[model samples]
Target: MSSAPVETVLVAGATGGTGRAVMRLAQSRVDTLRVLTRSSDAAADLRAAGADEVIVADLLNPEGLSAAVEGVDAVLSAVGTAPTAIPSGPPFVDGAGNRALVAAAADAGVDAFVMESAVGVGPEPSSPLATAFDAFIGPLQEAKAAAEAAIRDAPLRHTILRPGVLTNGSRTDLVTVADPGAKLWGVISRADVARLMLAAPTTPAAHNRTFEVVSKPRFPARNVSIDWTLP
Candidate 1:
């Protein structure tokens, strides 16, 4: 399938780590960087951080998302819940919120969807490290797995990136991307993930693909090379 360049992109969870990195980095790359946030107060700062427009909406409630995704070429979701929030209850953002977003994006005619998922959230024989990580996070990984399934079933073209441990380290641009079942285990910076998410929509190789991403110089799995430049 052919993928077209994104002139306007809507970023969900623009206040989170990877989302912030995307907001900071996407300023010069895209014609318009739109952000969706739950807080109306975040609008000014998001604008200052290079967001051309800010739509205040919560993903858990799907009603307002049609407006949130309207007129955007692509949707990039970095939404996730912290481990501490696991005990609180259902309606976990990782699964429910993202599923809602996927539906809304498809409804609004968004061309592509990019999701930041965690490793071990898809398929069988998950690596030991990923298994342990999932166990530590309780139901979060399961929620992400469901979200991944929702994306796959949706009509829109999608790219799901399952990153190992995420850190606040710098963007090295040396990332190792592989199929989900690869023996991939390591950490990657939020900045690097942001770079790839922004690039995925326009990169034909990344369309309708799911990848496991990790920082380079670690892990023995064969890496998948993708042209990360925005067209």
Candidate 2:
């Protein structure tokens, strides 16, 4: 199948770390880059950072998101709240907010939807590290799982990237994408994750796939091929 060009990408949660990175990287690649942010205060900064346009809209409002999704070829969602935060808790932001985004994307007939999730979200964690992380963020993990389910059941082509513990470190460019049941665990920079989000739409192996990602030290030989059919 021929991959579609990512001309205009609407990034939800464009004020966050991963979202910022996505905007920075996307500026050079795509013709138009738009962002959905809750604050108008962020518009100037986002535009300075290469966003062609910024829409001030809350993800929690489905009606607002409908307008935000217009004319975008794809939607990249990096929205999530801190585990300790209340009101803007996981149930609302991660679960309901993401669900709204997915529904709007489907309605708008977007070519693709790429979402950022966590490593320990499914029925069980594939690695010991993920299990420990899950124990730390129980409710948050459940919310992410619910959000993943919503995307999986949506009509648009989707790519769900579940990254291990996120860090502030620089990008390693040495990423490993693991299947659902694979025991993959490690720390990855938010910038690297943003790279994957930007690349997902054009990657044939990434469409309608969920994978775990982690950055590793440079190996003797690199294996960049993604096993799309891996179980």
Candidate 3:
């Protein structure tokens, strides 16, 4: 029997915590996995982790992004600057940088674009944690909001995942997904987020959707369900 067709996925910010997890998971699922980064320092490591190609590209530099997204069936972006860091913070990386990537993906004829956003980025905060974080990284949240708008306006199919506070915990394989305004909040492992990103392209419920996610432990008891899917 013929095997299922494999996708060519381009992962931006492949050196980040979530990005690394995504690349690791994509190794076995994707036909060709390309990682985009600003430096070559991690090239060898990424290759060892299963990246078919590592391209040097800075999200701040739009001219280099075209080559990064080229020839990929899907694009998964986990790009964002440190909240405390200035200059290269939200405005540049999350706002303008992500906008550029969305445009590039549309131009490249990429089938899908999956983005890792954060909670409290929409009109309001869903939890106290999001409210507190937003107080410090308001600009970053604003930038992410703008980036989401750009992705929505883009022609290609898109799935934007707004995960709650991230932790180094193990994957629970149980995720709580709700609409953007839903009060879903709590910490989740970067690995779980990566897994969701991996499934986004093929999951029908994720198409053209923007959802907030948290692990099972954090999900409200009344709403908990093993069959909950991204919508």
Candidate 4:
């Protein structure tokens, strides 16, 4: 059996590559597509991108997020931070920003929360490429790890997808989802990840699970099925 798609979905980081894909795909699935943006200048563009409503709020600001998430059925967060040197002040968006969003979503009683995470942040063994990325952006990875932990501890049904080497290619629809520690490394299009993230809330098999996703027919396939059927 399958569940119906949620009525409303709030897409955080709606202007980013993956977030744009989520917003585009969500147009026909959910009843309302709400997009959150840090800049009001993005409002017009987000609306043209098929967002039913654009809520201008920074995920870094916890106090302003309540109204953005209010009454939404699910939240798909593609928020992330660029690599920066270790800081003396507040944490980057990967950690504190996502944590704040989770808090707001929980307080608003959102049903499902899905986040885009890196493959190397969890307990998974790192690939050579992943290793180098970590070395370059170690701080961001650490922050993402913290955010993942916070999502796990929160009182929300969540799906965390750890994708390797994001690309701007088109959606292939042929994808493989495996354990986080499966040690798989490959490039996956942002469109494909967006498809899975949007489907996660309604896909019972995806709830509360963290997995590494890669385009299929690539290296290190675990060759196991986990019921990825979408509603």
**Best by TM-score, which number?**
1
Candidate 3: worst-modelled 10 consecutive residues by lDDT: 222-231
lDDT of 2 by residue, 95-120 (tens): 88899899989998888999999888
lDDT of 4 by residue, 20-75 (tens): 99988999878899999999998998998899999988777767899889999899
Encode model 1's per-residue lDDT on 160-229: one tens digit a residue.
9999899999999988999878868889999999999998998889989999888954654478877876
Q: TM-score for each prediction?
A: 0.96, 0.91, 0.90, 0.92
Give each model's whole-structure lDDT.
Answer: 0.89, 0.82, 0.81, 0.85
Q: Which scores greater on TM-score, model 1 or model 3?
A: 1
Which stretches of model 3 miss by more than 4 angstroms? 1-6, 87-90, 220-231
Pairs in clash, predicted candidate 3: none
Q: Please estimate how well model 1 matches the true structure, expressed as its whole-model Cα lDDT.
A: 0.89
Which residue pairs collide, candidate 4?
Answer: none
The pairs that clash in candidate 1 are: none
Question: Candidates ranked by lDDT, best first?
Answer: 1, 4, 2, 3
Number of clashing pairs per prediction, in order: 0, 0, 0, 0
Q: Where is model 1 poorest over a 10-residue stretch in terms of lDDT? A: 216-225
Q: Tens-digit lDDT track for model 3 on 1-231?
A: 111133789998898999998887889877899999888788998899889999988788789888888888888999887876755444568888899999999999888899999988888537776787688788888888999999999997888999988877787777787776677768889999998887787776677888888885555542323232321
For model 1 the TM-score comes to 0.96
